[model samples]
Target: MSELLAPALSGAAAGLGVAMPMGAMSVLLLQEAVRERRPAVAAAAGIAAVDLGYAALATALGPWVAAHVTPAEAWIRLAASAILLTIATRGLLPTRPAPPPTNASPGAGASAGPATELGTEPGPSAGAGPGPGPGSGANAGPSAGPSAGAGAGAGRTFARYVGLTAVNPTTALYFAALTTAQGAALRAGAAGAAFVTGVALASLLWQQALVALGALAGSRISPAARTWTFRLGYGLVAAYAVKIAFPLP
Candidate 1:
């Protein structure tokens, strides 16, 4: 009983270690949905999938990697920080043409296309919530109508997020450290499985919460607020990357 308890708690704690940064992922996803009118379900799934994969893999391989790979973590952190910094800089760049709608067309069909299919929906109008419309600010660019490549681009966002998460590697290192600390308790197969399961559960719950929150926040915020939100989110994520890259003495 105590054996299982230790691992489960460790796993949950590890999963939640990035609560602040992960919250940024949520905000970014929601902002993407509202401003770009893209569906976030795929992005949310990508984020959760990476989290679960990293947790499980860390639990399984953390001990060996911790022993062998500890020295290179700094390099890994530097590379990841570079990736995050690039992403942040891009966020602060001149806004592109707003992406086409990622949702299904309003009517006339049973099998709705994937919510990520671009150019499949109608143009934004004054009454359309969240999207740039009649009330959009002077600086706010007009949202796009339809384009040939929007689907591929929408899909790429999901893959890019997965790539960014997979390359970070610090989360796995943290998991490995936690598993190393709980060696004896996790020696038992049942206890180890319990810990990994707890981790998966926590990751899933947290990611789902992000998706729900993003969906809810879509219409409530004005376009300017949405723009600043991305700036803040990107900046925060970049800061986290820097912290990972250059830990203080």
Candidate 2:
């Protein structure tokens, strides 16, 4: 138990080391959390899963990946940059308002006859309910709104974050480097299992904390403010894309 505990603790540290840094994925995660907590939670899980997967990959093929993959790091960075740029471009775009329903012509109702002629009045609108209030999930309409789409497609959100996390092969390299540095500590079966578990838990905890914080902030701000905040985050993401595209010497 003690041996496993040590490896687990070491893995936790490694996980935090990789995850605590603020980067493109982190910005998107926070923005998503502000938009919809449920999807954000899914996104967080996706991120953790990828982190653990990469760690496992590194453990299995550390030396080879590190050697062969280093030469193509620039290409990977460019790909990641392009993806971030695309996300920023979409986020910065203004959302178009839904079109209003057309009114019926006076003659259009003639076929149905007047309500008085039928001896019955029209009932209330079907599915009528109170509009969603600010800071509440009520506004998340069935067909539209952030929560509607995001909540409905939580699995998609998870997959998206998984892609986002996986795009940077450097994460695997990082774990590989750790494996080299740690030597036999990661080679043992029980210790390795503990380490992977630790990595998963640590990464998930930090990501979820970010989600909670973003949700709290979103609830406190007005809708306009939230919109502007998201725009600002996307702008930052675009800047990160530029940095990734052109790293300094």
Provide TM-scores for the models: 0.65, 0.78
Model 1 TM-score is: 0.65
State the RMSD for candidate 1.
10.4
Q: Indicate the residue-level lDDT of 174 in model 2.
A: 93
Tens digits of per-residue lDDT for model 2 on 1-249?
888999899889989999999998898888877766777899999999999998887776678879977888888889999998988887676422324325756566555466424433221111111111122333444565565554656877898899989988679889989877887778888888888889999999999999999889867876556666767888899999998887632
What residue runs in model 1 are displaced by over 4 Å at the alpha carbon?
1-10, 20-27, 33-39, 96-155, 247-249
Instruction: Give Cα distance to truth, residue 86, candidate 2, Å.
Output: 0.4
CA lDDT of each candidate? 0.61, 0.76
Clashing pairs in 1: none
In model 2, the clashing pairs are none
Task: Report the backbone clash tally of model 2.
Answer: 0
